[model samples]
Target: MDLANYKNAYLTFALSIQQTRVVSMAAGGALESFPKNLPRAHKDYVVDASAKMSEKLKPVMKGVSGSSFEMEFDLDDGNPYLLPLVGILFTHVAGLGGSPNVDYGGLLKAQEVVMLFAHLEAFLADSIRVICLKEPRVLKKNKKMQWDTILECGSWEGVIDKMVDEYVFEAGWGSIKDKIRNMRSAYGLEIGVSDTVLNALDAAEQLRNVLVHNGGRVSREYLERTGRNDVRVGDMVPLDGSYIEKLSATVTVLGGDVFSAIAVKFFGARPDELRLVFKGAGTVLE
Candidate 1:
């Protein structure tokens, strides 16, 4: 639409915000601040500036939407004055460059473009929150293994010694060894504890010792790294993105049930439901 038409509409809208019975006029209040009946050349200048603003903002909006977040940017409410100022500045620049049509109106429209971008960005953030809440399994399915079997086996020298003595004297080596192996096999897990988990457990144990015996200063970092294999010694900043990514990985390990919601929302099909449509030949899980 033409700049005048848009201006009129905007003025009406702004007035509607305040009171309807007064027949609000854009030529007054904030509107009175601008030139009347803006020249086409001036409108064109603003349109171009607006286009530039839109171009700059497009990527931001796209990023937010893709990430499942919701955000909103309203130029009218957030920074109405600044937006027009930009248009006016651009117009002055164009005029200085010998362009007669250049004016602040174009700069004002640029504000709209920025506002549109912020609004969409906010919307994307909001969407991510909604999607996340809908898929609590994102966190639930990614269960942390409480203990490393291999590590436990390796470190529990005293326990193993006692058990071995009992087995040798009472249970017999053949039967006891076979029983242990069988138990491990049944759980589909190795009896040999994982080195990673073991390391984490050791760190945790050390932290516990320090805190209890030495009065070590407790911090969030200490708690996080205490029993962790990849623990770093220092404060840790909260990384929501990393947390979500980790959650996704954990869910994937737990049969990736969290992705079902993503598929349903994005592709309009549940994982299992899509499988049926794809047929028996398709791989259901990666």
Candidate 2:
């Protein structure tokens, strides 16, 4: 991770975070009240139309159960019902009269938090691959590969690439702590993440797990991992916009910290050099 490589990696990570933030903002905006500042008459007409559409959808809605349903479409024969049904559902749900039927804003925020963590995990894994590729000695103690797998490689670089891929794949995306420990033990890269960032990342990881595995319901595992005693095991995890913003900021800071640490430790980057690189890359480190 020389100055060039460090700049490239940090900028790439920053760009990815920006891209995710843009998408999250767009989704959040879409979840807001539609047709803002509409006249009263138009609002009344929209609400009336929605009521009528709901009535018409009664038969189709009756068949829908348990939060979702599956429908098959034949490509050869154009589906006549899809667009009209979508329009009705969209109008009905987008708050033609008042608030949406469901808390789509909260759901979208939760989803954004989950996606942020996913991007962080991908960056961590990619960092590992980049480091191992640069210094094969870091993987000297890596697990031995099968003879057939090695034989399948056309060249030594391919074998090394495959070996690195397997090594990272086997490591698995555990908790932030687990990932840090794996990096230290496997690649000897000590990523010095701050307590603030570490706690936030751990909490975000637990939240993501609960949302994905436990239907966003707080569990004892999440409480223990996050050290959060305010909410009981059965309570729903709080995923408000403010919390999501905090998590997003934490992710950006942690990414910068990790990248800088690797550059300094492995590539002999100085403090001044790191700062200059970050500045040149238009990355403001808080």
Candidate 3:
């Protein structure tokens, strides 16, 4: 009855519902506007690629945690699912072939980066559900709820938020999800990752790039009247500290989600085993 009973958990549930709706709407819109003039191959490829990638990544990409570790992503797979990442990248490259500032090189790279993060985010969320359900924390924190309850004290929302926060602090993907979420919302759709997820993904991606690419860093001097250099960059930036923090965060977030979803969907063994499968959302709550 109290508003506090809902709070953060309710917000997260609402956001999840909203995001699902937005994705559905976006897909519907895209389908509606499909040019009749386009070749059948284009549509076939999109459907085939999305389905294959979704299936392939669904199994292995679980619990990515948005980490910056290159080794974490170094899978040698000939799965058909991976074609979409390459396909999406090629589209942008072809479209923006001219001009240096907004040209093919930068645009293609950006497309890959965006697609990679999108795939990573979904994988992380799915992983959290799997891990948490399979290996849940003993529910000592809230004695009111039964230990057997899948989501203790109805605290799945808090669990998700905590995981996301940890992932953000650790990964460092540069708030790209936030930017994309905001952009989508502005256009009247509510698609987004949580702020916690966004932060972790950004940090992870950024730190990973710095480590793998041997990218150079330059210090730009902003002169005040007194000309005192604040937060100056030293000779060589140690990538170790930043990357470890990000990877740790990623683990927690993805792990938590896997736990929660599994608890919700598969707690107490398969629904048939517990005779609770029919007690789904279709039933009215007392």
Among all candidates shown, the one with the greatest TM-score? 2
The residue-by-residue lDDT of candidate 3 on 145-164, one tens digit each, is 34545355357766544544
Q: Candidate 3: how many backbone clashes?
A: 29
Please give, for residues 163-253, the per-residue lDDT of candidate 2 as tens digits.
Answer: 8888677666578767876676765665665555566667778889999899999999888877888899889888777677767777776
Evaluated against the true structure, the overall lDDT of model 1 is 0.35
Of candidates 3 and 2, the better by lDDT: 2
Q: How does model 3 score by TM-score?
A: 0.22
Point out the worst 10-residue segment of candidate 3 by lDDT: 277-286
Over the full model, what C-alpha lDDT does candidate 2 score relative to the true structure?
A: 0.69
Give the alpha-carbon lDDT of every model. Answer: 0.35, 0.69, 0.38
Residue ranges of candidate 3 with Cα displaced over 4 Å: 1-122, 125-197, 214-235, 240-246, 258-286
Candidate 1 C-alpha error for residue 225, in Å: 45
TM-score: the better of candidates 1 and 3: 3
- In order of TM-score, best first, we have 2, 3, 1
* Superposed Cα RMSD, model 2: 6.7
> What's the best-to-worst order under lDDT?
2, 3, 1
Q: Highest lDDT: give the candidate number.
A: 2
Q: What's the TM for model 1?
A: 0.20
